[model samples]
Target chain A: MQKLTKEQQDYQNFVKQKRPKPPLLKNILMAFIVGGLICVVGQVIMNFYISRGMSPKEAGAPTSATMVFLGAFLTGLGVYDKIGKRAGAGSIVPITGFANSIVSPAMEFKREGYVFGVAAKMFVVAGPVIVYGMCSAVVIGLIYYILKL
Target chain B: MAGKKMGLQTIRFQNPPSIIATSSIVGPKEGQGPLKDYFDLILNDNMYKEKSWEKAERKILKEAVEMAIKNSNLPYSKIEYFIAGDLLNQIISAGFAARELGFPFFGIYGACSTAAEGLGLGAIIIDGGFADNLVVATSSHYCTAERQYRFPLELGNQSPPTAQWTVTGAGAAVISSRPQNPRITYVTTGKVIDMGETNPNDMGTAMAPAAVDTIVRHFNDTNRTPDDYDLIVTGDLASIGKDIAEELIKQKGFDVSNKYTDCGLMIFDPQQDVHAGGSGCACAAVVTFGYLYKEMMKGKYNRILLVATGALLSTTSTQQGETIPCIAHAVAIENL
Candidate 1:
């Protein structure tokens, strides 16, 4: 075996020095609480829509849309990014996160004007998600329809 | 002049360029990251009083370059070249910033690997005796990158949790023929690698193989093991990519398990909601120039292996269903 050089040996020594431990417990606690709260708000909104004489099936779209709207609104007001900065993946996976994604780009391009700048940039992040989502949806829908036949 | 080419893609410099100074400027979001204090400047606002995101991106590049020169204690006119690029369309950020810097500019585009690419080029230029002092800089603003590459932020669409966030920042380093510590000793240029990954949402996976290829090549050519370096860093591979690279490197018989890390992962805390972690040209740039550079200068790190990874896909290519092609450039920095 080749002898370890002074630099190589020194690296090993320095690496063993006390490094800041990962903030595991605090992060997990924050994610759990924030994620749970988001789900609760979603459930409450869904229930509110259903209580207004709308069937559960009919309320699904509006509930999701309302959450998305709130997400976008918060993102526009620069609140979601702040919460997201603190909440981690908990805030990112929610429907509001999706709204935040779209609105975040739109707000950034607001100076480029409404039609070209804002509208064009509106779907940059989520466009791929939607395009793939729609293509799969169409294929799956066709397959299901044919299966029923 | 190009340096002497050694094994596969290695470049053995005649006179290695020394990093005289480095400066990194990040947005407020990145300012709150774990390495916040390492940065030279962090704007509290994304706009930074600029009218447009593109303009703000250029401003960051300009400021970073100016800061690097100032920190180098070198006159701006003494620098011979400005080798830089950014994620904006046509890399306008670098181009516009170059106009302000008044240097002989060489506009490059290596996606997130622009920082390494610029450094590699600058090192070669200085080593080849082309010029004495050169500057390498790159920037990427989250908003500008978002609008150009993906969707506008205004749409309020949801991004997959696997999606990587573009770092809003700029990094600049002044490289001189004058002797100094933490010099760029060696460089390994990477070839484009694509394994048919089409999902743009999960970039970490798509770029991992490229990083693996470059790391393996660098190790093989240099005849050095992972034990030689204090740390090995990949540009924008994030968490998922870093894991894949570690596995792939193990398969290549190096076993760089403990020494390896990704700048994307290192920039922000895991609890900071950066999805798959950071991406963009500035991701690696800011981390290296801002954080790692200082640590190395303090003699905290004796040697570092930097492999800056870049996804070589454009908006039109991804839209056309072309699989994402990725590249990685490796540079060995050692303090002596």
Candidate 2:
């Protein structure tokens, strides 16, 4: 790339002085705390399901589903948005985050109609994750079957 | 009578309309800012007990218009016209308020620059004998705008450092033939200018060039330097836009760094994690009507130039892979 003009260089310097620097340390701390708390909630839910006469693996599935439902509900109630704003990426670190991904687009495009808007746009964000997950799972399962043979 | 055309893209009002009164209303976040005391009302909640954020925006706009009329000492029936706009697709916030007030209305859409555009047009109508008394109002809400332009509130996505929080507020100003201290002296309407910026997350950068264009045109047309005004304020440029604008002006052989400030940066405290600062139609509207208007009344600032900038891109347009087109409009308000 060519060197910037003197005027452009000056502009860069001026902008640097005026622009704010984010508090990296504080943001990292907040993300750690918030993300950690969300994980703890998931664990507690899993434990509850286990104590209610379910295996740990079975508990895990229900707990994840519950978290997704909670996330979507909180998003509809406008609570999660505020938390996302304050907590940054920390809020997007769990099954709840995936729920947000689905619900947000559905809500945004609801004006566009159900079939085209809600149903179609619902997976616009999450489709890639689903596709990759299935593809990888199939490949892993085939490998496991071959090893057993 | 045709107003005097001063230089290119500017109008020098022959009989400048007197700015009789101004009113501003902001959300709780802005209420906690430095200029909090100057606004007339600060909402405790975004919804104001309303069913939706859109309705809340309309409520604030109506309140601001009512407050401006009351402060102008004009009876509700006496106001001749209402000119207003907002960031909504149909600008329903302004439209709904106009419906509620039942005034002769002119709806405008300048995106974030609506406040200055409304003021400039209101002044023209008053000066041109189209109306005797008029009010210019504009508003925006964070919740209403976010869902429309970006993702829904529940997305839980991380906003980058360049993102700006939309200020939830409304501001209104009354202009009339009645002699008042601060009067509209000049208007510089801007042309649509875009530099092919497509990033929706960083709107300040997209709109900053337009701000520069208008500011430079104002100075060039009026044959006045930045030093002529006590304070040179731009609406909703936020921190990033303001810095770029200051540098751009410097390239044009003027330095306004000492006196210039942006309404976006002024209305929110940096510690609040508002990213770049505030944006939206109300960002400039509230800061101008709330803080600057009150300060001018105290004889603190004499001559002021308000240049409001806007990125005139719709969510539909952005989705279609169109670059953001932006504009800015400037009006000179002076204590005469």
Best by TM-score: 2
Cα deviation of B4 in candidate 2 (Å)?
0.5
- Per-prediction DockQ comes to 0.14, 0.37
Instruction: List the pairs of residues colliding in candidate 2.
Output: none
Candidate 2, residues B1-336: lDDT per residue as tens digits?
Answer: 344898899999888898889999999998999899999999999889886788899999999999999998899888989999999989899999999999999999999999999999999898888889999999999989987888766677778787899999999999997777888999999999866666687788778878888989999999989889999999887878888888888988999999999999999999987989999999999999999988888999999999998998887788788777889999999998
Which regions of candidate 2 are displaced past 4 Å?
A: A1-60, A69-90, A102-149, B1-3
Clash counts for all predictions: 26, 0
Q: Give a tens-digit lDDT track for model 1, residues B1-336.
A: 443887889997767789999999999999999999999999999999988888999999999999999999998779999999988778999999999888999999999999999999999999988999999999999988876776545442345656888999999999999998889999999999876666687788778878988989988888988999999999998876777778768878988888899999989888877887999999999999999999999998989988998988887888788777899999998897
- What CA RMSD would you report for each candidate? 8.8, 4.2
What is the fnat value (0 to 1) for candidate 1?
0.24
lDDT of each: 0.86, 0.88
Q: B150, model 2: CA deviation in Å?
A: 1.7
Return the interface RMSD of model 2.
4.9
